[model samples]
Target: MSHTEKEATLYRMSTAEHQCPYGLKTKHLLKSNGYTVDDQLLTSREETDRFKEKQNVQTTPQVYINDKRIGGYEEVRKHLGKPLPDPDEKSYQPVIALFAMTALLAIAASWLAFGSFLSIQTVEWFISFSMVVLALLKLQDVEAFSTMFLNYDLLAKKWVPYGKIYPFAEGLAGLLMAAEFASVISIPVAFFIGSIGAVSVFKAVYIDKRELKCACVGGSGNVPLGFISLTENIMMVAMAVWMFISMF
Candidate 1:
């Protein structure tokens, strides 16, 4: 076919009650890729079912190219060489988003408190906010986080309960640090956990040369354990030390 003759036929459900989003996406993709679409709508429930039965297909948003069945949304994407994302793929998106959001929040918080967008307190807020958010992510599935934590955490390996308690401890330290209250308690807690975590991550990723998923983002995430994971632990350690010195 000529460049201007690229043609596609789409059969998608667009009933009065329900509209399929994937159908819209497929249509948009076809148009963006310079295809002329012969849009066919299965307007009612009965009509959709009959169309599926006649076509011998189970799903909506079916695509046809040159009268040959190109399949549904996902299959059409594959035919166009644009496959869907794999959730289990190892990526740093979760951690990157977390740090970026916390940094912005810190700046906003500093502005609210000290009447400036950037300040020493902004750095403190960033660390505390990150700790709280990270702890919250782990708290989503404590059992899962604990299971993963035991893989590299020395304390968790030694005392199994520590795996479970780590999230709560981290959160408490963060809250106390943010409030600038009970330095005696928060300082020590942060320092102890941070120190242990830094050592454990160093041993696992650098010394032992192990490849593992990081629980730093969440139990279910697939972000690889590496320098970024090490950086998180180092940040915690530095924050704790900074808090201690500032207090004295």
Candidate 2:
């Protein structure tokens, strides 16, 4: 019996140059879960390679209970009933978090600026702040954002460069709108881009029925293009129109 029910044998790489983070995590997890861990360290590259060959396994951080092999970090987590994250899983969590954060920011701004939390100004601030944040996400990795944006954006597909310029334009419009500065420039800019975006989103999702990732929350994420994407564009257009109408 190599291991008891409450004992686990963990094989991991521990060298001068590098230590496996997953291996450490597995060891910690085993200890935390009331399991006694027998940590077997592979101190060198050759030793690690030899262990892999001997075990007929490709990776380290292997766990065993009652002499039964339990694979790597992810598999160990499964045995411990604490599964790791699945990267390919499609989720609305990112967008939901963004909206929730922006909503709180909006209310906070309203309280700070007007000593109130609920007002037409609050709504405006929410939209403007969202624009700024959304643009900031895109600006984080413009190349990645552009690569995703071109997948469905009508204008981006035609012009190619519009994808790269979009983040700056959105940010500028948002700042100007938020400050109520340069309305002459801001309103038109917002309306133009917003309208184009709305139409493109509508056509792609509704007309073409092509399910693609939205570049709204930046390209690195897996936010599916749909209702929220449409709403974002519509809000910008509405904000621009409202500002324009108010000028009269």
| lDDT tens per residue, model 2, 104-219 | 99999899989999998888888899899999999999999999999989999999999999999999999999998999998999998999999999999999999999999888
C-alpha TM-score for every candidate? 0.90, 0.83
Expressed as tens digits, the lDDT of each residue in 1-248 for candidate 1 is 58534799999999888998999999999999889999999899899999999999999989999889999888988988997898878999999999999999999999888899999899999999999999999999999999999899999999999999999999999999888899898888998998899899999999999999988877898989988888888888898899888977
> Lowest-lDDT window of 10 residues in candidate 2?
1-10
TM-score of 2: 0.83
Model 1 ranges with Cα > 4 A deviation:
1-5, 15-18, 43-45
Among the numbered candidates, top TM-score falls to 1
Error (Å) of candidate 1 at residue 18 is: 4.1
